[model samples]
Structure formats: structure tokens, C-alpha cells
Target: MTTPAHVAIIMDGNGRWAKARGLPRLAGHRAGVEALRQSVKTASRLGIEWLTVYAFSSENWSRPPSEVSDLLGLLKLFIRRDLAELHRSGVRVRVIGERDDLQPDIRLLLEEAESLTAGNGALNLVIAFNYGGRDEIVRAMRKIAADVEAGRTSSASITPQTVSEALDTNGIPDPDLVIRTSGEMRLSNFLLWQAAYSELIFLPCLWPDFTPEQFEEALRQFSVRERRFGGRNERDVVSSSA
Candidate 1:
């Protein structure tokens, strides 16, 4: 099977998973964290170079205060508890999102994770916390605007590559395959700009229940598809008729 160089996942259905089990939402979130740990291992073993997961979104703040608090607590716990193991496993941690207003402690922990794993190269683990795809594009635009205003570069000279470099994911390659669990069929404001041509796989299993087998299956699904971007290939002509 063809293994993608990069894979991104929208981990969804935690609350629904908890509801199905008659457990609290936090319980589901906790299980989701374990799923994440296992996913990291699976990705490494599969030789996937980059794995980006949608952990928390900017819009998630609209959730109930108690739930939000619980999520934040879980983030802290996960980082403090898992950072050592992640670093030792040769996973380079990268966090992308708006962090200017985050709690000082939370910000520090995120920075520490990136710094500690900066030298690791086995896998790239990107956590999209407090992230929104539109927000990321807006931020990139703002940076470009600022540069233009400062006479750093003419507006006409700015290209797609320039905008991409200004975004939080600068230097990171776009995902080759994007997966979403819990049967969701939308991107849900995740990696909007970067995933323009990524192959998508929507899984029926919820985030907490996602397994290595499912991950491997998604790769299997990706391997047979032909990606021609906007252009047409001979395969497309035959496949379209079939």
C-alpha cells in the first residue's frame, strides 16, 4: 500500500461516544486522548512522516463553561503526562493556532513541547489547538497586509506561497490524506487552505473508538485512488466511465 507522507485527522464524536455509553463527556474526552496516543504510535510504525490532529477549535469555546474547563484541564494533563514519552519516541511536536491570549501556563507547556521535540525526526505530530481554518487564513492575510504596509513587499508580488509561509503551518507540508471520524463528511473548519487537494476519508467510528486497524484501513483506501489535482490522467478517463 502507498503510505502518505502526511495525514491529518478531525477527531470527532467524543460527546456522542460518551452519551452512547452513559458516561460523562469528560470520560469520552479522556478516552479520545488514549486514542490519540495509540494513533501516534501507529503513524510512526506505518512510516507516516506527519500527523496533524484537530484537538481543540476556536469555536469550541462556545461550549458550556464546565465542559470547556474540563477540556482545558485535560490538555494540561495530557501535555504534562505525555511530553516525556512523546519526546523519547522521536516525535517532533508542533502546535498551530492563535495562542496570544491563552493562559500563561498553557502557553508555556505548548512551547516546551515544541522545543523539547525540535530535534526529533521520526514523526511530526501537529496539534491544532484553538485552531480554525478561516481564522488561520485571516491571520495570514493580516501578516501579509502588514508587510505590504511596511513596504516589505509589494502587494502584486505576494503569491500563494507567500501567504502559505505566513500561516501557522509554515514550513510544514500540506496533508496528503485527511481523515475524519464519527461519520462526519465535512472539513469542519480544519485545515481549509492547506487541504485543497487532499484525499479525504470519513470513518464511522468515533474518536474514542478509533483504532490502528481503522487507520490502516484508511491508508488502504487512499492507496487505490488516483490524484491528478486539476489536470486529467488516462486513469481518470477510464475510471469516470467505469
Candidate 2:
């Protein structure tokens, strides 16, 4: 099978998963963290170069304060408990999102995780915390606008590549495949600019229940699909003539 170089996942359905089991939502979030750990291992073992997970979104702040706090707490625990193991396993951690107004402690932890795993090479693990695709694009535009105002670069000279470089995921390659669990069919504001041409797979399993087998099945589906990226293959030409 053709394995994707980079795979991004929108982890969803934690609250529903918990409700289904008659457990608190926090329980489901905890299980989702475990699923994330397993996914990292699976991706690395499968020789996938990069894996990005949508952990938290900017709009998630609108949730109840208690739930938001719980989610942030879980993020802290995941970093503290798993950072060493992640680094030891050769996973370089990268966080892409807005962090200017985050609490000092949370910001420090995120920086620490990235710094500690900066040299690892087995897999690139990107955590999208406080991220929103449209927000990212707006930020990039602001940067470009600032540069133009400062006479650093002309507006006319700016290209798609320039806009891409201004985004939070500057050096990272675009995802080849995007997977959303709990059967969501939308991007949900995840990696908008980067995943423009990415193949999408939706799995019915909740984020907490995502397994390696299901991930492999998504890969299998991707392998059989042809990606022309807006172009047509020879098969299309033959069919049109016949």
C-alpha cells in the first residue's frame, strides 16, 4: 500500500463517547489522549514521516469553563508524561497555533516540548492547540500586510508560497491525507491552507476508539484512489473518446 508522508487527524467525539458510556466527558478526553499516544507509535512504526493532531481549537474556548480547564489540564499532563518517551522514540514535536495570550506556564510547557524533541527524526508530531484554519490565514495575511507596509516586500511580489511561509506551519510540508473520526465529513477549520489537496477519510469510531487497524484501512482506501490534483489521467481521455 502507498503510505502517506504526512497524515493529519481531526480527533472528535470525545464528549459523545463519554456520554455513550455513562461517563463524564473528562473520561473520554483521557481515553483520547491514550489513543493519541498509540497513534504516534503506529505512525512511526509504519514509517510515516509526519502526523498532526487537532487537539484544541480557538473556538473551543466557548465551551464551559470547566471543560476548557479540563482539556488544558489534559494537554499539560500529556506533555509532561509523554515528552520523554516521545523524544526517546525519535519523534520531533511541533506545535502550530496561536500562543501569544496563553498562560505563561502552558506556553513554557509547549516550548519545552518542542525544544526537547527538536533533534529527533523518526516522526514529526504536530499538535494543533488553539488553532483555527481561518485564523491562521488571517494571521498570515496580517504578517504579509505588515511587511508591505514596512516596505519589506511589495504586495505584487507576494505569491502563494509567500502566504504559505507566513502561516504557522511555515516549514512543514502539507498533509497528504486527513482523517476525521466520529464520521465527521468536514474539515472543521483544520489545516485549511495546507490540506487543500489532501485526501480525506472519515471513520465512524470515536477519537477515543481509533485503532491502528482503522488507520490502516484509511491508508488502504487512499492507496486505491487516484489523485490528479485537478488534472485528468489518461483513463479520462480514453473514456471521453469512447
Top TM-score hit? 2
What lDDT tens digits, residue by residue, belong to model 1 across residues 1-242? 99999999999999999999999999999999999999999999999999999999999999999999999999999999999999999999999999998999989999999999999999999999999999999999999999999999999999999989999999999999999999989999999999999999999999999999999999999999888888999977899999
Lowest summed lDDT over 10 consecutive residues: which window, candidate 2? 210-219
> What's each prediction's TM-score?
0.97, 0.98
After superposition on all C-alphas, the RMSD of every candidate to the true structure, in Å, is 2.0, 0.9
Candidate 1 collision pairs: none
What is the clash count of model 1? 0
Candidate 2 on 153-239: residue-level lDDT in tens? 998999999999999999999999999999879999999999999999999999999999888889999899899989999999999
